[model samples]
Target chain A: MPAGQAVPRGPRTSRFALRPDERRSLGFILPFVLIELALVAGPLALGFYYSFFKVEYFQLTSFRGLDNYWRVITSPMVLGSIGATAIFSIVALGLTLTVGMALAVHLERDSRWNVAVRAVALVPYVISMLVGSLLLRWIFSTDAGFMAVVLGPIGLGDHSVLANPGSAMAALVFNAVWRDSAFAMIVLLAGLKSIPPSLYDAARVDGAGAFYRFRRITLPLMRLSILIAVVRLLIHFVNVLTFSLILTGGGPNGATRTTGLALYELGFVEFKLGDANALAILVFLFNLILVAFNLLLFRERRRAP
Target chain B: MTIASSPVARPWRRRARSRSAINALINLVIAAFALAPILWGLSTSLKPTQDILVYPPQIVPERPTLEHYAMLFQTGIQTPIINSVIVSVGAVLLSLGIGAIAAYAIARLPFRGKTVLIFFIVALMSIPLPSLIVPTFTFLANVHLSNSLTGLILLYSAYQIPFVVWILYSYFLSLPIELENAALIDGYSRFQTLRKVVLPLSGPGLVASGLFVVTFAWNDFVVAVAMISSGESKTLPVAIYGYLGFYGRDWGPLTAAAIISILPVIAVFVFFQRYFLTGMTSGGTKS
Candidate 1:
């Protein structure tokens, strides 16, 4: 049926078209819009608002203005969490990017082995972070852990990584990269696919070595994808909570306590609402800065084109 | 034959063979790195209590046992699994229904503020969820929604709706507008057209988005930990964490519970393997 064949008779005559198209569209959309605003946008605004006030046991007590922010900024735990988060994000992001790029490059072609490895690699991504952390705990456990069994004969027996602060942090970083690199691989794989093969072919025809072609062609084309993956991985790493929570429980003197875990303790465990809210806002600002940086990279790429 | 006898061709063949060998080596490492932890967990899950603590642990148990699995089912793990299923499925249904409709409006209908709405969804996608937990907890408590599965479902749907809109919006855009226009010419209302014509075409999109929502809601810990403290509404992830605390030395049942927690997720991934990859990658960076 052609649209022009239907005459615009009285709008009220058609029972199905009782309302105007605009109204009907609005009706279809308003439910989602209203619920999303109330649940998502509303809470975000409330987080900002709550940062300025004191609340105890689910009741708002008084407005503290900047005191909460002042205390949170000066708090050692907050500063420590910042430092921890920085270390975790840098190490995790670097490893994930390296591993993910390698996987993408090797698995870019269509082969049975590549396909199987790709499928298996995604298992960790789908598994809950909590469960993934648990799996790592078992793998790294001191008593009969896989690592223990593998390393026992080499005089590195009974090693409990989670019992030591530095090693626990390493465990956290390892787990972060393990779960997230699959995501990075998928993103970079798409980037590799998007690059015109003709560019590589042209370089080959010019007698460029494989390494030269990769450096001159693949790296430049993959720059944006790398940036995107870095930002996303940074966000996940910086906000990492469950990995530490379920694995190390921030043990061995707060070794793996990222800012996210600190916030969890503040809000849920200690009920320090004002401080928690202030810290939440601070984390949100940091995330916004990262996202802004990502947008800048994107804008620069667009301008170059 | 002349080329085959040439020294250059001999070196080239050797190089090609070595390159493939290197590729094979890399593939082996990748598979081991990815599957080692999970496979270890599975091995431990099947091991008896005595074998789990033995020195020079065997990669494959000599006598595989289902005792730990029986123990897992007999314990409190069941509640968390049930809770996870309810919240995840509820989130999938809620987000798809509401998000698909909104995506349709954005894709097909020329409504005012449509661009702004799309931008809003994008911005919402970037909001760090952990930062919002404090206020969300407070808000939920005030509304008597705290510690409830319903509240968790609502929050999960809200968090997932942004990706739903982003992915489904693209899916709907790829569809020809003329189809909807043709339905309109047949005197079918927009809602009827969407219900009768558009939905059948959006099956793949729905499956993709639904799979993502299920994975997220099921895998989440930050939200569930913040919102629900009691076993009444605690999810699998949180419950499994509690198991770690309680059974710190009981690797047998603990690993078994961990396996049970992840079994459904692995099933979904294996069953919808293609959609999961496509949806997640596409959702990673919008075109």
Candidate 2:
């Protein structure tokens, strides 16, 4: 029987009269819920459990309460990785948002040319991150790189970009922005599409200039999309490992080793499972805090106006 | 009124023309920025080894050769490509099969804890993959599924199901309930109604979600690298990563392998561009 229909007001017959529809709904969702619990939640809790233990070669030997967390907190290398990740995230996120918003605004019109340009913009994002990073690596190669050729006349051809710490980090950030700005553009473009053209028409009739209308109308309306883009990109930049691995290999004396690469090295390369798990938990908590901070910032801005 | 007759319109038209010209110039730069790297890679791939390292690198190859591509194929690039196809297609099918039903239920049925379930799925969507990689690896190893394509498929499916559900849930919600109601009134069961009525109308939604899942599975590098160790089982991205170590500064074959790895995904994206934009924007903006 369908839900919300009368049940004849009889005795508590059968003691579990789940309507047929409810039963079918339960059946439909049961497998999905089970898989999520088993795969996502179960492993997450297990990771927390593993973080407190002395794991060697993937085998948990003994429980050492808070020892792994303490070690991770005290390790200078881990701390340096966090700092590097913060720098990367900030620069990459800022560039991605600015470029994405600019592209979205310029290409918001649904013309044929706009459609084709939007597709081109997304090409890097659609390709595999490893491939994109490797392509950039080729472009930055000291010997036969595109940059070497382009900068040859300017006396910078022999300057090896990947061999320098500062430029290596910059290369990493550039790779991220090149790939992710398209994603941010897509999201922000959706926000732009939702804004009615009549708002612009009305503003023009009232003698409001383009900048004034954008500030008073578009920015206010795009707050959520901007927040979404920021949060998503921040999370991604903080945790992504491909660019560091493929483009720079965390090279130039470990200058570009982000937290994600550090975690991979800890768990897979060094076999320091306990330390990796602890660091992972810490990073996960940091992400939650970062997102919460963004939400609060946006909320405060909303309240101000 | 003619442009000559209206004095006020002249400067406005001139200004608009200048603005459009500037916009077109910016668009060209953006497009060039986007395409230059891939085009450079293609050019490098086609160039002979001697031509590749020539000073003032040739934007266009002097004598394009198929040697790099031939070398890639000779070394068995097809194995990883086939492995990637199997894993990606398997993950997409699995996620869509499982997510579609749950999404339909959440959209159409009245059930207890429905809102909580949705919140739970959304929360799952944000869990960082790095944090889960260690435990997931261990879990798969214990089950003896690590280093296997099936294991990769299962892991990818689990990772992508939340997104699939999110997109499909919005699609189902937007769909009119009357069609399902009509099916129900005709004495069809909920399952039959969903299969016969709802699923038929959700072709675009399925394609969009499936494309996203396939792309995620195909482009993934960290998980595949961590999980798979065997040569035959490695996916295309991981296999291409291996080229860095094996080729070791041989940009010709490396670029060729990279170009080959991205072809399938680029083709899929081009074909389904419209659905991709709609699905991505809608799914993201909805929640």
Candidate 3:
């Protein structure tokens, strides 16, 4: 029975028979596997399947091959939505990263006041996106809203930001940055915490200024965290729906209708399940490509270092 | 030691003082930017209907009133609030219950295809919710579970479990395995070691993962909006959205309802603020 000793074979066991540990492990993981297969994997495959056929009122009427995909690809509305999504995601990602990095650097120290400030900064993130968008919508409302009141002294009270196409898109980006910058800050702050204080001290002793220390010591060390935040925020902004839905309503002449909202309208509003599923698959692929691109960029940088 | 008394140290000390003051100022501005909309919403909710539309919007209302809050309840905001609570809590419980088991298996137990399972989970985490919405709705409808609180709970749990497993998997891996080994040597089975020894030591991990799941379930809008159509199963976000159509610029009651919807999440967040960063960064950083 000792290690490296051959055991006496009393009876041959079937190859299909699972060992005790395997059986227990299988039991432990079975429920989660079933849920994922049933809900996540199953729905994803079904959506892919539905994308190939004409679905009327949630019924598969006929196999249309790639017609649905072609229609989605060629649709002007879908093309416009993709353009809008690109603009929103790029701008929002930029602002969110900048603001989050600033906040993280400023509040990295552990103190009572800093803790309170961090909490306050995170308040917007904890609030639901729906409520946050609504709050911003109220603030930007031309009639009796906060922005109106603030701009009144400047003789711009009647000028509604949401009424203008460009500003409406800007407002959507602001809402995203307001809610998600704190998330970026939290991740980056963790990265900052992991760096040893002695490294900063050594740099300071070597006559490195603050900015120099940040460039030399912080940026390289914080690459992984920044990449993590960037990837997460990109995925979020690409897939986000509520900001456009509630804040701008894809409004001012559909200037802010993101792909997510387009998918929503196609599937729910127009009830074009086939077109929506096809678009859904397209958008999902776009998300994967975006994420993959970020990872690849980070990998390249990591290799250089 | 003599450098402390030199003139060179004076400017550095002065610079440090000014830098702290500057940091404080910047912190104030950032906090204000983060909280102004929320405070404005709260202020508007407390103002009288007429005062809400006043030209010089009162940061502090001239006549503060609870009329909006009362009206929100009168229109039956409580039903959606209750529904949200039940669904969120139920989903969190379900995700945590099964996610802990799966995470334990991946972290501690030796099993074939573990790496593949983990890869599948990570991939699932990135699947956009919009892509899954139409199909999930159809799937639930086919199974006769759509538009029900149970359906929402199940859907949310499925979406949330992958995240829960990822977080707890790292946490469990960080935990020392010697305790479980000791328990097993004391005549306990693997499941018993898991329940009695491992779980007892994983309090912080459970709390962190559970809090994340709760936030996800509570803040979700798209899935709930896609699935449920009736007022009977509406969550808080959908209900507040309904106010946009029903009230049509009635800011007072609308802000009040929005505030009501966020109260529970804010409260939980404030109480458990410490756990969130760990929960959030662990999964991302591990990758």
**Candidate number achieving the greatest DockQ relative to the actual structure:** 3
The alpha-carbon lDDT assigned to residue A250 of candidate 1 equals 80
lDDT of each: 0.82, 0.84, 0.85
Instruction: Write model 2 residue lDDT over A1-305, tens digit each, in one string.
Output: 45677766556568567655578889989878888887777766777888999998778999999999999988988888888988999999999999999899989999998999999999998888889999999999885667777777999878889999999999999998898888899989977888889999999999999899989999999987788788777778888788898999888888999988888888888988788888888887886765565545444543644
Candidate 1 residues lying further than 4 Å off, grouped into runs, are: A1-21, A152-155, A294-305, B1-15, B283-287
Evaluate model 3: give its lDDT. 0.85
| Candidate 2 chain B: worst-modelled 10 consecutive residues by lDDT | B278-287
The ten-residue window of minimal lDDT in model 3 chain B covers: B278-287
Question: Isolated chain A: TM-score per model?
Answer: 0.87, 0.88, 0.90
Per-model TM-score, in order, reads: 0.91, 0.92, 0.92
Q: What tens-digit string does per-residue lDDT give for candidate 1 at B1-287?
A: 37746877888778878988998888788778888888888898898888987877888987899999898787757788899999999999999999999888998886667766765665566566776788788778767898999999999998888888878988998988888899999999888888899989988898988988988898888888889988778998788777788888898888888788788889988888888875675433221
DockQ, Cα level, model 3: 0.57
For model 2, residues B1-287, the per-residue Cα lDDT tens digits are 27735776888788878988998899899988998889999999999999988876788999999999998899899999999999998999899999999999899887777867876666566666765687777677767888999999988888888888888998999999888888999999888988899999999899988888888888898889989989999999999988899998999999999888888788988898987775565322111
lDDT tens digits, residue span A1-305, model 1: 25557545544655544334677889888888888888866776777777888877756699899999999988988888888888888999899999889888889986887887898887888887887888887777787566776767987767778888988999988898888888899988978988998998888889999899989999988888788788767767777787777777787788788888899899988998778888888888887876666555544644654
DockQ, all models: 0.53, 0.54, 0.57
Q: iRMSD (Å) of candidate 2? A: 3.2
